[model samples]
Target: MTTTSTDLDAEALDLLRALTGRADAVFHDGQLEAIRALVDDRRRALVVQRTGWGKSAVYFIATLLIRRRGAGPTLLVSPLLALMRDQVAAAARAGVRAAAVNSANAHEWGDVQRQIAQGQVDVLLVSPERLNNPRFRDEQMPELMRTMGMLVVDEAHCISDWGHDFRPDYRRLAELIRTLPGEIPVLATTATANERVVADVEEQLGSGTPVLTIRGSLARASLRLGVLTLPTSRERLGWLLSHLVSLPGSGIIYTLTVSAADDTARLLREAGHEVAAYSGRTDPEEREVLEQRLKTNDLKALVATSALGMGFDKPDLGFVVHLGAPSSPVAYYQQIGRAGRATDNADVLLLPGREDADIWQYFATASMPSESRAKAVLAELSGTPLSTPALEARVDLKRTPLELMLKVLDVDGAVQKVQGGWVSTGLAWRYDRERYERIAAARVAEQDSMLRYESATTCRMQLLQADLDDPAAAPCGRCDICAGVWYPTDVASEAAGRATTALDRVGVEVEPRAQWPAGADRAGVSLTGKIPPEERVESGRALARLTDLGWGTTLREVFAAGSPDAPLSRGLLDGCVRVLKEWPWAERPTAVVAMPSTSHPELVSSLAEALSSVGRLTLLPPLTATGPGSTTGRARGGANSVYRLADVWQAFEVSPSLAEALAGQSGPVLLVDDLVDSRWSLTVAGRALRRAGAPAVLPFALALVG
Candidate 1:
């Protein structure tokens, strides 16, 4: 029953025609070779091609040919939910039966399992996170692994620590692949991997088997790449406003932050453009709707963050514009690859911003947990199981970092998550200090390369390809440097004014803490349950968020470490006045009180004095910090609410004179501070004022940390 190479080639071509619905469709240079390695030779293969190079076709065709000879279902490990949906549809079009089990489709998992047991499903797709689920790992994965005909790792670059978007969950694949029988063929594919990432992935995949690496040219002839250096964020927004319509067709507008995506989308809609915002915070249903809208050309663009980066298929997407540069050239290349996939001419532009570096630094360190924090987490879980919130109360780590650390531990076989919660497995684990340090250093180097890409004199596409280690990279003749400037360099004054107005309209409602954090009593605090609506402050306002596009730059410069703490400027005073003018509170403040500030005492005192003079109200003596050391230091910012509250509970004390003075006030008192981050400071301080007989407390700040 052995099939000859010539027969296999003819069958693959026929399947490709069915997959693409084009009679003349032919495999790209390396696509057929990759498929042959997996199907005919039964060898491990890794395919690195550009976005539009038909990587999925290789796996789909191989799955069909293998199944025709009566092999088990193909197990595809995809990254995103949107990707699963698109892949399921594509499989159906090619006469393949595919089923997916993920968080979004939880209700259908039982049915999917039944289908797999009945031998009805030809391929099964899953997210990497599912591999660690206790029930599936114990009950289903063993059988699936034994019976799987082939293994596919889509978006394979995530498996390497050297990759820009490395996920700890992906590391689990190494163990899974190691356990597979030698006869099972395997395939890994990615469009964005450099020499380092490729080497790492190949080594992980091969383990002891030899892996054939097939890489094609990374150049996209239809894409026209360019970079526009804008001096300020406002100018970048202005450029989008003035020239977005001039771009070829519907595409994506990427931003480095979620707030920027939202703000940019709002501005674009106000200017009469059909656009919507997409981010991780978006609702699942809404995200699906937005993807469809963009696909059907119902919307001109989607202002998005990296959440929309991979596996989003729009064959004719017209352009990609960035409000701020990504941290690395690899990520930049992948994002821009979304465009010109199936079109003759598409635009790719980068509007570099000054704040891009700060954003990059924040994300770089956010993923790497400190050794002390990791030990604390392990120690807390040494005996008993605890939910995420319970663990957060016991450890000083925030929710995001704590979860990330737990995933790392889970993948390393040091912990297990069960029905009750997460528990330590009593396994000895070592903190790889050298590895994390190397990762941090690599991140800094990548940031430097991105800067070079912005300022490079040669073709922009060539710079990106060179960073990705594409050996055949050459100057693309369609780029700005080679073909002259294709995009406008000027922003109209009217459009600039409109962008200013949009970014300047700043008033984010500070939600009052409703319920007490779990395990509050463990920190020696007796408070529990709701904060009693009466004691809680109403929705308050800040002059601007430190992450806002308008005043963020100025606020960052003013609040940077070692910067001089000067008196309130006229502009700040004016902004405060405007905030007050728009206040929707039922009662205005008759008195003002300042939070204890050990860092910016001058700034807080000046702001309080200026408000007192402007409002003709009495300025109470400021509260004092009673703790020995600086409790409000920056290191405490990322602690949980319970820990943050405990740190500031005994730190602030209102003098008896000030308390007595507050007892005489008739209306609400304004509680002012230089900045508001955790809101625990304002919560505890507001409780003190309420206990002192003020009718209500209103929290106000010059800036808020988003």
Candidate 2:
């Protein structure tokens, strides 16, 4: 029986009351319409509303209403663990039973499965990556699909390759959507999609049926936006240190790199602010704790990367600050949307950095797979399954790129993951070169738009809105340009000094390799299993990491392509001296030796000679490359440990004079190099020195690549 509009209105009122715990609660402009489309019309719809616009409420309310009519469970494909937690809590308030199956809750899978089979679960949330799990894909997914009443895709922008933060796993949704019954309602939602992305997503969801696209204005009246172009990283850090306390309430400070996030959090703590760092490397349980702390106003801020981007909820968060600009305005808009959600007059600030472009380039190239590498991986897979490590041995690609390529191939139907590992499916897959090229071009364009945003004379908010193709965008009268700067421009001298000191601190510990990589023996190296502790060099020191806030800027200039070889600067020499002065070794080094440098011989020689002169130690002849491949120039960083070991093993030879000098040394020997990347060079070089009768070897370098 068809329900009357008055009856639907009454039911919506009840859902709103149950969700917000207020009898007078009401829907926003289009919230009730969206809920009715899903619950009454059973239509596939895409909602492009801003953050905190009650998107979750629409879905949860629809789930409850559908379940009341005795429909099957609603299945939601959420992108983040944090989002799942928030959605589950929201569903419970609306009296809809929701359960989640993700990586963090492995032990509860059986209970969740049983609950679903018994019709106790009204909604089930799973991550996009979980859809590719072997057991779930082959066994549980079919059952869920057979009885699913509605399907919702949160963070739907990820489904399009043209989107800024696209993931290969999300593309699997297209195939899943195609199999769904026509009557089953489907909803896709996101806050940051341009015309291009919206069209791409609509096409993916079509499956020969029309989709209801509900796009609203992208403007946020509660957010006041501004951009500060800091000339140096230390200045940016100084600004944050001096100004974070003056912000309205607890919030988030976003950084582009993990090192920057950690460094910023440490400096802020030193400044007596209660802050924590959040990133992809953070432990899952600790992330939950941190999220809870933020929700309850226990932390002043979380220095985070994009890992905390979507679905993190704190309704009254007072500010959002960016330590460096993201690659696109769409991403920046999404991040800043976290603030001013449930409150008025939240501050949004962007401290654009000079190194942002370089960081952006690194990440952009890392995401694109090389055609040769992808083909090589497919060639190696056969009837027999091979693990990632085994595949890494056969293919020269590194671990991260290999895994990402496998994900893409899996979605393309070229491979299947089984109990043992991955195997080819005998399906012919064509490389979509034109599509990839177009995506790369689009990314570049987006980056240029972000740059424009930093320098726009008009409203900053409008620029972002324009980038997202919002037709209703206009001057947001609260921006720095719309109204003159309302924030303090002066950074306290003491705060600047503190930031400089923190950035200038050197000496990062380089942990020695503990074991040979799994497939080392198969790659013509005899070594296997654990590396003997005795043969390993002690944990060493580098003057700075290539990613450090202070030295990073200077080092990038020095290491740029075609940079002339030169001796160490006085500042660098002082840094190296400080590292030596703070050394906590058991015995002072009696001798010094340099690693062979095909590219910067003069720099290496001058560094070793200078250290020897200052420490009053004998300077031994430098080591030399033994074979043709020994001096293959500089090995680019980011290769897996197995490939790095194979590239360096037997590649270096100890000079006779160096061996003689090692034999005469009574205490430890200092092994100096220009840089340490994979640490394989230090490992093999130190091993050679040890075999030459040196009692101990201590590795030191000018820089460490992160």
Candidate 3:
């Protein structure tokens, strides 16, 4: 039976005081009413309020009130590990016992499970992926679904494919919600959802019951918004250096990619500012330390990708500067919302880059799973469970994309991740082609919105507010548009030069393939386990990664569609010479050989000739393409190790003349190629050269695409 005004208002106030550590404290607008909706009416609710608006308070208070009446613990499906950490800490302050299970605390899982079973934890915080854990799903979830007092879905916007950040695992919540007991209240919360996203999330939360949505103004009055259009990374870095100290308390510097974040952090550290890179590549343990460092103002800033966004909270974070704009205005709002939650003023600036769209396009395409790929994955599944690697051997998709597709399929009931691996559920599924097309079109629209945000002069804050469909979308008089560029607009020449020099210094080490991909034997390739050192290429070098801050622009142009394959540019040749000069190889090359490259034969041959001429080494005849599908020296669209290796196996061979030449030489052979994607081509080519009697092979490339 519903509580229906059980009369806990005084106790709720006492709990709020205990939470705030103030003798006299009260609830924010709609907070008390939302609490009543949960504790009294036991209804599903969604609270969309700005960051620091105390959304957590409503749930925490509701949980406490409900528990006082002898209810089970609240299960929170949070989005990030940092969020789990923060939630656990906040629960402690409110005197509510909390426990979290995430990738960072795997060792404590048994303890957490035990505590949950013993009813020692009042609230449980978990990543959305935790819902799909085989053991938990089979053993613990059924019981939790029955007994859970309340369910809280934080960052609920992620549940909607229409949201800027759509998470497949979060889709699993629909099943959980559909199965949950009707009496148990549900709460969904997000600060970043626009109207469409809100409607989607609201529908999901309702399941069958009606959902109560409480939306507050999305505006952050304290943020002074601005955009600075920079032509190059060097100038952007220069601007950051000139103004970082002048900005408010320690904050986050956002970048679009992991390499960009790392590159920015390196340059900043070299400039003597205390900063560190935080991205998806960062270790979970290390990420915790970095989050604390930022909260405590121990570092000037953390250069980060979107991984560091969401649930991270520092009441006094005084600034958020984007090195490049996010693909969507909503995502940008969520990121910048991390700053100025408690303070009266904060600075929010955007440094738009020419490379932003390219990066955006890459992510946009990569995130969408194709219907053909889905069909391929389903065809490979069987009644028997198959681990991801075992499944990869039979499919052409890469590991990441494959796993993502499986997650989507899992939510759709086509497959399930069991204890051993994934198994087909024999459930009929249809690809929602029209829905996906709609989502794709929405993504394009959002991208265009970001473009407008960059160039808009009509109050940046108001524009973001309007994008989120906030009722309070009035203009702020402090934006760059309204105030005539309040922040620094010029970069220091010295700082720009330093950044340029650092980024210009190129040559990333390309580690050789250590092992053949699994399923190679099935593909008619005998390679397995570790590649023998005798047939392996020595550690190689590339002029730059296509994503790097330096030479990447030039490399992108050279590989872009419609770009002609020509001889190495003068700048590329000079870069090659510099890379070789500092390569620190074990031995100098005695011979230079070019890899077969129909698409870039001129580029490869010119690079090989340049290296040979500069080092005064013998220029042997280039390798020849052979075997089926070998007419094109480039790979045959291989997406995984097994497939890539099969395409390249026996694809390149040394001629009788070249074999004889290699047999007589003792020093390492410098093998040149235009690009390296899967590294299988280089590995196969190097093995052939080694078998033909080259002592060692040194693989070099103009760019590394993977």
Q: Global lDDT of each model?
A: 0.88, 0.88, 0.88
Writing each residue's lDDT as its tens digit, candidate 1 over 612-703 gives 88988789988777873223633475677778877777777778988899988999998888788888888877877787777898888888
RMSD of each: 1.3, 1.5, 1.8
**For each candidate, what TM-score against the reference?**
0.98, 0.98, 0.97
* Model 3 lDDT at residue 319: 94
- Please provide, for model 2 over 167-195, each residue's C-alpha lDDT reduced to its tens digit, 9 standing for 90 to 100: 99999999999989998999999999999
Pairs of residues at least 3 apart in sequence or in different chains that clash in candidate 2? none
Per-residue alpha-carbon lDDT of model 3 for 1-706, expressed as tens digits? 3343535787788899999999888888989989988888889999999999999988999899988888999999999889888999999999999998777777888898789878897898988898888877787777677668999999999899887775899988977888777889999999998899899988888986899899999888889999999898889989998889999988999999888898889998999999999999999889999999999999999999999989998989999999989999999999999999989999999999898898888788676778888888888886578999999998877788888899999999999999889888989989988888898899899999999999996989899999999988888888999888989898998888988888798898989999887788988898679999899999999998888877887898898867898888899999989999999999998999998876777888999998899889999999998865333324534377787777778788799999999998989999999888778888889999999999999999999884
State residue 490's C-alpha deviation in candidate 1, in Å: 1.5
Candidate 3 ranges with C-alpha deviation above 4 Å: 1-6, 627-638
Clashes of 2: 0
Candidate 1, poorest ten consecutive residues by summed lDDT: 628-637
Error of 3 at 699 (Å): 0.6
Clashing pairs in 3: none
